[model samples]
Target chain A: MENVATGEAQRAAELPMDNDAFAGFYERSARPLRAYLARVSGDAALADDLMQESYVRFLCAARSWDGEVAGRRYLFRIATNLLKDHWRRARSPSIEEIPEELFATSPDAARIESQFLLGPALAAMRPRDRQLLWLAYAEGYSHREIADVTGLASASIRLLLFRARRKIARLLREPEAEGRQGRAR
Target chain B: MIPKSCPRQSEVAAQVLRGQWPAGCVEDLRQHVNGCRACGELVLVMLAFQSARAQAVSGPAPVSAGVLWWRAQLRRRNAAVERIARPILGAQIFALVVTIAIAAILLVAQARNVPRWFSWLTQPGQSPGLHFEDLWSSALAMPVWGLMLLVFGLAAVAVLGGFVLFSDRPRQ
Candidate 1:
């Protein structure tokens, strides 16, 4: 146990020495990153696991970035790759099997209806579409930032976001159309 | 989808979604969208989708960063220890296999020679050249079971040494 502690101390020393800086960074970024992971992968547990792994990997990485913006972009890129790798290694859940929290019930009728429409609407899209749309729309990431984070071409983001928006809008309206059809019947 | 006539429709919609239009370009973007039905619909849908997505992913994180950092450190330490112990484990298994093989061969050889040696000993008139004292000083000093037990004891000691060397528990 003493030897292990010594070795761990040695490794910790070798890591980035600014714990306060890293703690600040984690505080600023962890929540949004967790939310991004949960929304993209549709699993809260997986999101938490991936978020920790992403931070660990970020700390271990050797490259340098200019500022917090660049650092954040790089961290997100690492996280995106990790998510892709995970899906490759395991059998991903179908859209219907996405976590229930995404479509949680609410007392307010409008909020409940929006949640109902939004959860499955987002799920029905491709993972890449969901990632691109969420980052662009929900997170307010600019085209270049999304490109940096997602490894997509900056020129392609506009068209892709457009299509993703269209698809989600169409999906959101599908339930209402179904209800109208039921009323007619 | 953008109309064939509006090549900049996607770009305008993307800029609007990101709130990245230049200060002077805002009115141009607005006028362009107001004049183009496709661009107008695209803007409205983008805004609505952004709102829904925000609501979908909003919540508190499951675990805090400090806890995650601690867990990551533990995992890394465990991995390092495993890396150091893997070769020791391989060597232990190799030594055990070799020891068992040698013991098996010795047992088979002794079993085959024991009856012949006993017959030779029973014939008192025949001089076998080998003296009792010499035989007693050599392999015959102990019974087969005793020799086997000694070999097993040595093997056990080697295995125990290996276990101490390659134990999963961290050394103090």
Candidate 2:
């Protein structure tokens, strides 16, 4: 009986840091997660809040984390769900308010500024289109990676990216980028 | 679907951005983009987006010197959530509760002098020094039969309660 108790205690000792593991894991994944969230929401504050919530969720789920599953991929998967939830909770605007200074920043400015034009272009897109563009372009995800991230078929990634690019290009060409919707025809 | 009016190379640029470059198309796109300034510029923006994002700070914002203390508080909050959730969700707790209930009912029936299967087993006729009242009353009374019955009862309760608590029932 004593031996069995000791063995169980030893096994528990080797398991992932029950609560202590969250700090290190959060530190490791936070930066990329923030950037990913920032681009998706186009609002830094909202991204920050989502980042905190995502990590809290990560910590809660960590009790179930098997060390073999790549932690980063799972975390991103969680973040993707949270992002979808965030979007769903938001009411759709009759007209998207496009910012005029999209892409107006110098190339070396903050990525947010560098992608300002892309931001509204992203905002102008349907949520799925925005997700496809961000997952591919900003997250450095391959077609397969985007497919995993968004649960879309891998074979369709190229076609979807193509469609996303056309939409962005059409948006960029609008004479009044903010007020008028792009006319692809 | 690719817009029919888009330059052939722009489609290639999207593929390249996705790291899915087709060898045949890359060269053709390169030559066309070299000749066309608009396609060339779009390619630059796309490439820049990728590069800049790669360098972006992803996680939490900057924290002050007392982040360790703040983290401790967050840990407490998380632990509290787990503590609350565990009792509601823990299989063992539910099993323990059920076991205690069953044990109490058995002990009560014994107290009431009711003819219980347990009392019948522990009755003096079948086994010496095994009457529940005497075995429990006497000092150093091992009450082997009662002890064994108690252990077996607890084990059965644990197993049965576990199945009830953990097994999923199909919705009607």
Candidate 3:
């Protein structure tokens, strides 16, 4: 541990963001990023893990962003990619229906289970639908920004967002009234 | 489904996200949200998600920024070193292979002369100068291709090793 820290200290001169600068960025972005991850992934523990990895990867990226907004977008991009990789590796295709039992083990897990009121309402929806809705409405991302963060085609974001909003509105309109909407076009 | 988006939807949603809907919002825009389906749904979705976000962020405080910063710095440095080491590792293996090939070729070339060289040393009444001459000839008897190949191989290994070790392409 001592040797690792000492070696890191020696190479610290070459790093882009110093402790204070990274701390500022981390403070400004961490909560929102975690919120986005948790809601999309339906897992608090994975959200925390992915959030840290996203920051580390953002720090490691070779290009410099134009400003703080760009940095935040890039951070989201990293988080999204990490989440995609996690999903692929875990082989759980229906992430929206992430089992309640999965979170029964911890306090944060329990909080996540209780916090997302709309989660179970639209829990059967596709992962992409949850991601698009969160990025669009919750994050206030324009269609273009949502496309950028989620790696969807920009031209398709409007239609996708519309479909996602329709699903959420119909589902949230009444818990008992779900799946009665005549097959949506 | 409306093919075109309602511009007022953005205004209403933005206001709601800022938690100033209806109060900070003008009466005219508030009425527009009530009438427009897009804007109405946008308000409901945004409000629910806004409350959900509050609950989510309030669940648990993440790790401290200082810890994140320190760990990121360490991981980034380690990744950079790993990136640079990959090509160097390849070059080192290439050098080792070439060195072994040279040793094998040399062993083959010197095998025929080994007994003569050993007997020349064991022979009595011969001057040390004749022994030196035989050894020199034995060295010269190695094939020209073998000699040139060894020199070329060593130079290639040196060049590749130097390039891979010195080039500093950072990991993304």
Which prediction has the highest lDDT against the true structure? 3
Report how far residue B150 has shifted in candidate 3, in Å. Answer: 11
Docking quality class, candidate 1: incorrect
Say what the interface RMSD of candidate 1 is: 4.3
* Tens digits of lDDT, candidate 1, B1-172: 6623367766875676565643435677778887886676566666655666555446554466666566555565666556655666786777777677766766675787677577656785663425776566666755787687667758766875666565655554
TM-score of each: 0.59, 0.51, 0.74
Cα lDDT tens digits, model 2, B1-172, are: 4434345654855665675543545576678777765565456546645654656754235443134334544564545544444544565566667677768766864574445335546664874236666555653454466666677777978686655654343311
TM-score leader: 3
User: Taking the tens digit of each residue's C-alpha lDDT, what string does model 1 give over A60-170?
Assistant: 664554578777778888899998888766665643354433333223433434444565556556778888887876677888999988888998888887777766666
Better of 2 and 3 by lDDT: 3
> Lowest summed lDDT over 10 consecutive residues: which window, candidate 3 chain B?
B163-172
**lDDT of each structure?**
0.67, 0.58, 0.73
Error of 1 at A140 (Å): 5.6
Off by over 4 Å in 1: A1-18, A38-128, A139-160, A169-185, B1-26, B45-62, B108-172
Fnat for each model: 0.23, 0.21, 0.51
The model with the greater TM-score, 2 or 3, is: 3
Task: Report the Cα lDDT for residue A154, model 2.
Answer: 97
In model 3 chain A, the worst 10-residue window by lDDT is: A99-108
- lDDT, residue A45, candidate 1: 71
Q: Candidate 2's residue-wise lDDT over A51-124, tens digit each? A: 67666555545356756235766667777788777755655331124332331322333454533555555555
